[model samples]
Target: MELRVEGLACRRGEAVVLRDVGFVLAPGEALILRGPNGAGKTTMLRALAGLTPPVAGTISAPQEAMAYGAHADGLKAQLTVAENLTFWAAAFGTSGIGPAVAAFDLGALLDRRTADLSAGQKRRASLARMVLTGRPIWLLDEPTVSLDAANVARFAAAVSTHLEAGGSALIATHIDLGLAETRVLDVTQFAARAAARREADPFAEAIE
Candidate 1:
């Protein structure tokens, strides 16, 4: 699978958050989107996932791509860990939840409600849902936000395995995810470009 973005730009009303960003990611390859706060890293990820429309340019992604946003959006706080997996598997038309549960080390927490799980546990459960999607491309935004060192290592291992299996990933994070042969794109450049555009017009507000 491959993902290609050409001159991708996103705007919120009159403010341009991202502009003229381009990249191509082939199967088994990964790219890390790095920048300081408000650099449009999260916006780019959302654009790749088709959750937010790009103000300009185009994104070409495989039909099977899946995106895991910064928040653990897929988890149902009312459901048990096992139930959540089961629901995700059904939604994705997968056979079962065995693999996902085992992959993320959720076996022991199967009976626990999602609300009762720790932040790391919730992140793991969210990752398990992504695995169950069986998509070849993953767009992850700050995937390791609340993980401790041990769980961070575990997340890295899971990502390594995904890449080894012919998957591709686009991650937006400040922390290292430990992916091998990963490319890095500094989104701050795009932000700077946006800033330059505003300098010519003193009345224009610079996008953060």
Candidate 2:
């Protein structure tokens, strides 16, 4: 499978966050998006995943084959860890959460309620849901939010497995995910130009 983006532009509300961004990802490849807090890394990932529309340009890919994992865990506080994962697996038309459970070290927390898990545990559960989808293209935003060093290694291993199985990923994060041969896309260039343009024209915001 191949995912291609050409001159992609992303926006949040009326504010354009990024522009003229483009890239191509083939099967078994991973692309890491690096940028400042407001550099629009999340917006880029959202657009790529079809969670948000691209303000400009085009992305060519099978939208149905993509899965998005946002910063939020998207878990139900009252549901057990296993229950949440099972629900996601079914929703995504996949079965058997064993792989995700083992990948994220969720065995011990499987029977526990989501609300009872620590921040790091909850993050792990959230990330595991992405794997449960069994989709080829993963769009992850800040995937390692609350994970520790060891858990981060586990997540990296999971990503490696996915790539090895002919899948691809577009991960937006500030930290290193430890994936080999992963190319980095710095979003600051596009965002900085947008910021500069806005600053140069004091009334740009008002006009928009």
Candidate 3:
């Protein structure tokens, strides 16, 4: 499925930071979101993921097609690794967890509770859930935190395979994963103008 956005604008806590943002992500493609700190990369991803409403503009994607991963691992501390995978797979109506487990080599930790795992191990488990999602569009925000070089490569490999299977990913990260058919969207180009800030929030006093 193709994802398209046009004249997009978003806010971070009542302050409009990005405006007029647009991009098209076709199948078998990846787009890297690049911008300095506070440039609204996370906001953009959140809006696209339907976690937050955009201040303006539109995001076009099929229903049940977007899978979003934010900075939080989205894991249940009480659940074992395998159980966590099973739960997410059930939510997406997909039963295959083997590929997800193999993608990040989580076999050794499957029986262990998430709270007992080390930070890096936890991160790998969290990211591995993406494979089980079975969603064509992945919206990830800073997905590589706490990961070492080798694990980072594992993530890159997973993304490559996803794209090869005609999927698409939109990731916001500072580290470059060096994947194929990738493009960068510098959101600073869409930095909201002064007038846009006042429009994002209604209760705030107008700026003159």
Pick the lDDT winner: 3
lDDT agreement with native, every candidate? 0.81, 0.89, 0.90
Root-mean-square deviation per candidate: 4.1, 4.8, 5.1
In the range 150-177, model 2's lDDT, one tens digit per residue, is 9999999999999999999999887888
Point out the worst 10-residue segment of candidate 2 by lDDT: 190-199
Indicate the worst ten consecutive residues by lDDT in candidate 3.
Answer: 199-208
Residue 200 CA error for candidate 3 (Å)? 18
Candidate 3 Cα misplacement greater than 4 A, ranges? 194-208
Residues 101-177 of candidate 3: C-alpha lDDT, one tens digit per residue: 99998999999999999999999999998998899999999889999999999999999999999999999989989
**TM-score comparison, 1 vs 3, better candidate:** 3
TM-score of each: 0.89, 0.90, 0.91
Each candidate's number of clashing pairs is 0, 0, 0
**TM-score, model 1 to reference:** 0.89
In candidate 2, stretches whose alpha carbon ends up further than 4 angstroms from where it belongs are 192-208
Which scores greater on lDDT, model 1 or model 3?
A: 3
Off by more than 4 A, model 1: 62-64, 192-208
Query: What would the TM-score be for candidate 3 when compared with the true structure?
Result: 0.91
Residue pairs with colliding backbones in model 1 are: none
